[model samples]
Target: MIHAHLTEFHGLPVRYVDQEAGLTASQVAWRVQGDSYEEDEGTFADTFEQLLEWDDCDEVRALVVGTWGWAHNDDRADVPVRLLVEAAPRLPALEAIFLGDYVSEESEISWIGQADVTPLLTAYPRLKRLDVRGGDGLGLRPVVHTALETLRFESGGLPAAVVRAIGASSLPALRHLELWLGDEQYQGDSGPDDWAAILAGGGLPALTHLGLQDSVRQDDVAAAVATAPIVARLESLDLSMGVLTDAGAEALLSGQPLTHLKRLNLRHHYLSEEMAANVADGLRGVEVDLSDRQDPEDDWRYIEVSE
Candidate 1:
């Protein structure tokens, strides 16, 4: 007998992909448009409730929902957001939730509320990964304490309160953290100091790997990295594709107490030879990445000390 796997995109409908016995897994992609689906907005709540009654649905392995746009418009009768929230109770098997361009647009703020998030998060106690990009200004305080192993906050600004909540909540299972700042409408300026304060207060204690991309300020990045005592526990750190400078590198090396960091990336930065040497000297055992520099092939040589 051939086994089939079912996956849903934007909670529209489930698409089944045929799977062979023990070989590689097959990949399938499905896209839904408003014209193709006949269900109006008012019927969404019921439709979603019925869909959630699937016997095979023990947990949601992955959920990708629209945050804003036509799906979230107040005038639209068939809002997928409402159905997604309502369907949350049925997605006990959900392990990962991906919020796509739904949250990225500027017009869908009215439909995206804190209440909508509560049901889904409350329902998926086993949720491991949360990837949210854009939407109404949803505060992070409510969901930061979830049992997530990998947390990616992209293109949105995180407020201080939300930052504090993540620190206070001991996320023991968390291993990977990715912060992509400055992509959407943010409430506060995510300066390095703000991030520093967040780490000093203990945001991600169990993080073993971290990635930061598209940060605006270098000093803030430096300050924030310097403040993270948890870096000492990290095995890999990626700071590629950002506005990080030599000062940031120096701050991370000299200020931050990263004793266990084995791999460090400093790609696409403004690091001088001296700063590179300083970093090489500070992180003696760690492998440093200096790719994407003006002088890519240049070797980093640390200063010699004679007694």
Candidate 2:
């Protein structure tokens, strides 16, 4: 679902330089096969090992993983996950990681196979940020982590289990959490009621920004979030990249006093012009995003990402 490739991660530039090109303190590079289907001379493991043995390996603090191999055969990132977990000791400076950073052209978000990243968290107890893009074969267990600050799952169809797993997990220092709940056809089966734990602010004490976006039943999500206990503490709320209508907007506008929020992002929606105007007019002090308005197809609303 991601169109653009990453230029930076964890406040460092992302590059594709070779070992011969040398590494700098301000940037991190990834070695990817030119073509997803091409048989690379060296596998991803080779590149990872090379990094571990690099003279400047200690300087590497963040990593951005791109194309792994021939994804047409459903190439999974399981090996990479294992490699990263095993290499945790060597990557002590590592604080952030973007697993599955490929764009749609390299691999469709839904088609990109991922694995249980729970072990990585346990291995890297100091890891503060993790951004994973893809849901196919993805896994997560509700494990408590004290240092994690941000966690994101970018998927076309985020499995319902993973959604609930995040809600059930205990993250005390988590400041921002973004979950893209793609279409059910791609595996995301979560509904409004599923967001209870997260919405209720069960275990997330430092959560200031929460995004439960790109859902099939966004109206219900909005309705649930309207009265959810989490909103009171969040400085920003993102309900974008889904099929939101006036009904959902009405619930948010009428329910809670959201004037305390600094930003309310509802981009890529199906809100009526009147409702859009109402949202802007209602949240005068709050920064409201009402861009990328879409027209329903034969009365059928479509989400931004549901592959």
**Cα lDDT of model 1 by residue, 37-118, tens digit:** 3434324234344435545444335544432234344333225545655566665656766554333233332333322344
Which pairs of residues clash in candidate 2, taking residues 3 or more apart in a chain or in different chains?
Answer: 156-182
Cα deviation at 70, candidate 1, in Å, is 4.9
Candidate 1: count the clashes.
Answer: 16
Model 1 scores a C-alpha lDDT of 0.51
TM-score (C-alpha, index-matched) for candidate 1:
0.65
Candidate 2 residue lDDT tens string, 167-240: 89999999999999888889988887678888988889999999999987888889999999999999999999
List RMSD in Å for every model shown.
9.7, 1.9
Over 4 Å off in model 1, which ranges? 1-55, 66-82, 101-119, 142-146, 156-162, 183-188, 201-203, 257-259, 277-284, 294-307
Off by over 4 Å in 2: 17-22, 25-36, 296-298
Q: Count the clashes in each prediction.
A: 16, 1
